[model samples]
Target: MRIAAGLIAVVAVAVVSSSVPPEPRRAAAQETAVTAGATVETEPVAHSGDAADDPAIWFDPTDAARSLVIGADKKGALETYDLTGKRIQRIPDVYPNNVDVRGNVVVAADDDTDEGVLRIYLVDPTTRQLTSAATVPTRVTAHGLCLYRSPKTDKLYAFPNSVSGRVEQWELTVRGTVVTAKSVRLFTLGRAVEGCVADDASGALYIGEEKVGIWRYGAEPDAGRSRTMVDGARPEREGHLQADVEGLAIAGDRLYASSQGSSDYTVYGRMDNKYLGRFRVVNSGGVDGCQDTDGIEASSRPLGTAFPAGVFICQDGYNLRGTTVERQNFKLIPLDRVVLPIGTLPIPYP
Candidate 1:
């Protein structure tokens, strides 16, 4: 009788343990926390909109400390903020989805009105303000924009992608102080495409297909539709990108891409598009951690003491302070700080 009772108790305990879900037990045992470098968050944007989308850093030609960080408030205007995070200027009545800087020109993909075009603005280096230049109609609705200057031919071009997956390259010309654009070539990446950056030195283009992954293509207009999948969002695979890779930016020879689905950023080799590693902007020095970033911009050229070895800017999906949820803003992380963990430093520009 004593042996029977002992056996029944053991069987009962085993049955109860088996009844508990295996998934929860497995998850508790297998899940591990990911570590990434921390970043510094700048002051929030003036207009508290959920539309603080993309950022472009325009360095001052004469004064490095007086550089301006231009942000696209996709809902209303293009705003310019000083390096100290003060809103200096705002261009109203324009809805810019993405913005990029090439030389003295600030090209943004506009969706404010019926005219789907690129709004060109000339940057006043002295005042660090953007002056209205001209608008070049792109026919296709512009969603994401990037400025590319060809190293082979020294031609200035703009690549804009539409929500319908149409990507076109436009050759931009400057006549006196005015800017205009002419279509050079067109291509597509099937589904929704956005977040593109060009490496003029290597003549390569990196674009993110929101649902798919990251792709590398030739910047030349006639480079044909040949493209290589640099990384895919496969959770099962090691070092694979999570879904919705939204932003692409190049810092020196490396590329930084936002993996929105994972709430982290992935790095890759700019020339070979090889997988490097992944990082997340964590809370540090009184700033909240970043989540679900959309657009990002990086510069290899150092900008004053704030960014001695260049800076990497990411659009914050959630901007919160204390209990109050503030407007979405951009966070600036020193490039050296970001690459320090991976043992990669900024290579000198040739």
Candidate 2:
């Protein structure tokens, strides 16, 4: 999660509570060595420091080659880029921390006001432009956000979580150019939390409690607080996850989470919630590797000749250009390059 420059020190202290234990040190050799490389990298965000945050892929159904990547510039805007990594649009003055897109609707967790808000936008398929639709206010301080379109109910929902661990599920409705929302459920995960993704096919919502591990909950409006631990951060448990579990993404039957403290990503089975493996994005082919990553998005849908088997987008916290430090940006890697020790099984897209 990106914090304002002035509040960085304050947030650092607030994130680690007394109940949480300090992270244990793990040797670099102990972590997975499998690596993937990026083929395309987006332009840096307008702000100088700690700006670029999360990304959501908008797959153009009619023409996958025309798909776009929408990202949140925590400093104050939302930027969109085409598959070739060219910046297409920038909606400024909105301090959004996380972003998600489903169908024609794009939602961002905005903290520009005293009360957190969800900035809703409608995407023009042909033009690939985002038009402001509505801003629904929430009680919590929005930090992480994701969208879900239930296959069972055919209704759209947004899950936005705050740094305080409060999560709110809102049901969204769109009519023509206008959008509306109603708060359906609210609950806290008991620690600072951020990353979240919903499995529309299984109706499961997974939340990452920064210091703890991943937890699963039902995505239905009436699902309530009941949850099951999918994995843990406790060193003794020997789990792949490290501290500060950041962004989460689901592609095919696989679930990916950014293990920030370790500079790697851990994968799991979307259907069974079983640990799959871990991999890192390393420097190769002129593009720098991803380190201290914050958000990531993956799609199994082929996008042109560049990414025949789809793509994986990551927010590179430490963007570099031939050893020269540059302003933060996002990186694009072909999904097929992400090879796991136990090869990924084919699962029909949801």
Candidate 3:
């Protein structure tokens, strides 16, 4: 999720003036004590400080071992990494807060432009590298973004949201190497909002309001602003979600979200939105755990032997090497190691 423009500028100044980085926050007691560790850690972002924000995993159907993981460096670049955690490609000169992929098309919410735009790219299947295709402008100041391919129509859609709660849905079309987008729907969520994900199978859209909670809306273009509350932050109700709800992703019948305030991840039943449990990544096997996470992504498709049941990727806010803090980076966890609620089935890739 993108921080408010005003706050970002102020924080930027402080970071520039300070020689020493601040200490990382500790995680408080949670409802569940379950924990897991990352199997792979990506190379740190090019810039220092809070530059790494979100990630997206692209499954290579032809060759599972060739699958790629793409991430956004809010400090002005988008990076692609291989299954072994090596940085393969870096596209510079753009401030992308969040990124998502559908098939071969990768879209990032570019905040560098005056009126936020979506930087589009098509991945080369053979080389597994991203090639710039087009730049589509958005109506709102794009802070968060996610892509969806409809099950009914099979048409691609992009949901780019702003810090002011404005979200616009655009239909994207690709012909040859050219790409275009058309606005189809718009709505406001009342407060500062960011993270969002679309359930193509159920036609459901989930949006996270930083101070409030997550809301459910229709993914169809004609579906109006009518929404239902899926879950709320503390003090509002008895729930697991902490304030500043950030990146969201779906794996099979479960929905995963970054509980930013507590430095953990919360799980819910995708069908009923029922709170299942929560877990934190802890230090293990020579690699440190993830803390103060900002963005997360998960997949259920088998990807090689290491991640046979799939993998989960998260942006580690405080990349620590023992007690000392290092540059921010993403962690890859084997999904099968994460214990889920009872009756959760392994749904195939969408």
Clashes of 1: 0
- lDDT of each residue in 1-115, candidate 2, tens digit only: 2222331111112233332212223422264346678899998898867788999998889998999999999998999999988999999999989999988899999877887
Model 3 agreement with the true structure over 202-289: per-residue lDDT tens digits: 8889988877778889898888998988778654544677777898888888888887876678888887888777777666676667
Which residue pairs does candidate 2 place in steric collision? Answer: none
Runs off by more than 4 Å, candidate 1: 1-40, 46-49, 235-239, 340-350
Q: Candidate 3: global Cα-lDDT?
A: 0.81
lDDT of model number 1? 0.74
Best by TM-score: 3
Candidate 2: 10-residue stretch with minimal lDDT: 4-13
State the lDDT of candidate 1 residue by residue for 77-171, as single tens digits. 89988777777898988889999988788999986666488999998777777898888888668889998888888888899897777899999
lDDT of each: 0.74, 0.82, 0.81
Instruction: Provide the RMSD of all predictions against the true structure, rounded to 1 decimal.
Output: 10.2, 7.5, 6.4
- TM-score rank, highest first? 3, 2, 1
Candidate 3's error at 52, in angstroms?
A: 0.3
Give each model's clash number. Answer: 0, 0, 0
- lDDT score for residue 76 of model 2: 86
